[model samples]
Target: MGAPFEIGYVFSFLPKLLETLGVTLLIVAGSLLTGIVAGFLVALPRMYKIPVLRTLSGLYLSFFRGTPILIQLFLFYYGLPELLKPLGFDLSRAPVLFFVILAYGLHTGAYAAEMIRASVEAVDRGQVEAAYASGMTSYRAFSRIVLPQALAIAVPVFSNLVIALLKDTSLAFTLGVMEMTGKAQTLGTLTQHFFETYIALALIYLVISFTLEKVLLAAEQRLKRHEAREEKAGRSFKLRRKGSYRAVLADIDAGKGGRL
Candidate 1:
């Protein structure tokens, strides 16, 4: 006889699975945080090139993106310790959690770099040039004029990256880091109720992922709407502020004021 799939199974086991949920969420949070910081650093070189650093950063992105993440994970978890020992680094006390984060960070950072660079580039060149012409230093111009616009452009890309990172957290289980999938596998093995365990796990993942996607989409839409409204307000203000200039020009051309 097969095990029944019922609400009882979920309610009963869900509390017991808190440890697994904690680990899974930790991996996702750790990876995304580390990856974004790495990516932000990588983005600088391309956005404002220091020739050698830019080349090196580009190489970093290319190599990571070109390789499979699973291989990268295996190499970091299995192979790097061997390499690091000779370099006089001790990895003995390091948990598998760190490797999961390292693998995810390097893999995701490569993609984030490209997305960020594109965002920075998407900023209007004229705005940057105007800042420079106004005596703003390169750094000042970038901070004030470039980065804000770039962030707006990058938000959508980053939201998707967050979703990808959420899914990729499952890979940690392969490395003996007992996250959600790992826990579910353990349950299935114990009870032989493969279908029940797996379906529940799938639903959990679906719920979390769907929730994050909706949040990101909502935030992205709000940002875009805010940007659009700001632009409209800026235009309206510029027109109103320059009313005298237009009125004078109209007076010169028409010999008198008609209706503004």
Candidate 2:
């Protein structure tokens, strides 16, 4: 007989589930923040086509995008032990959590670098040239003119990658990192609650991903409305100022320029 999924088990496991939820968020957010920052730096250089860095970014992106993330994780977790032995570094002695974060960060960074580089290139060359023509330094042009628009374009794709990163946190179990999935697996085996355990875990993941997507969608809305806000505010301010000046001029004209 298929074991009935018990709501009571979920209620009992609530505290433990919440704790694991936090751990899942930690790994997801930590890796994404680190990866995006690193990717931005790499993408910036590649966008500028900097010497050697551009080619290196291209190669790095190609290699990571070309391979499965599972293989990448395995390489970092297993291969690193042997590879770093020559340098007197023992993987087993190192912080396993740190390696999990590092591997996730590097893997995500490669894809993000390529995405950002593409977004940067998609920005209008004329707009960038206009900034340069207006006496903007290359750095200033990028800061003020290029990044804002590139970021706007990249947000949707980046949102998808965030979801992917969250899902990928499951892969951490192989590296001995006790995250959400690890916790779930441990608890399931201990309690023999496979069906109930997975159902609850799935719900938790769904809730988290949904909440994150909502926040990202809200941010995207703000970004998309930015130009419209600026225009509306500018128009209103100009109209108010013009109306004030017109009233003053009309009063003076009505008095035939006499002091009043």
lDDT of each prediction vs. the true structure? 0.78, 0.77
lDDT of 1 by residue, 90-156 (tens): 8966899998898998788888888888777666677888999999999899888887777766777
| lDDT (10s digit) by residue, model 2, range 105-134 | 888898788778766766678778899899
Q: Where does model 2 exceed 4 Å of error? A: 88-90, 228-260
Over 4 Å off, model 1: 1-11, 230-260
Per-model TM-score, in order, reads: 0.80, 0.80
Provide the clashing-pair count of each candidate structure.
0, 0
Note the residue pairs that clash in candidate 2. Answer: none
Q: For this target, which candidate reaches the highest lDDT against the unseen true structure?
A: 1
Clashing pairs in 1: none
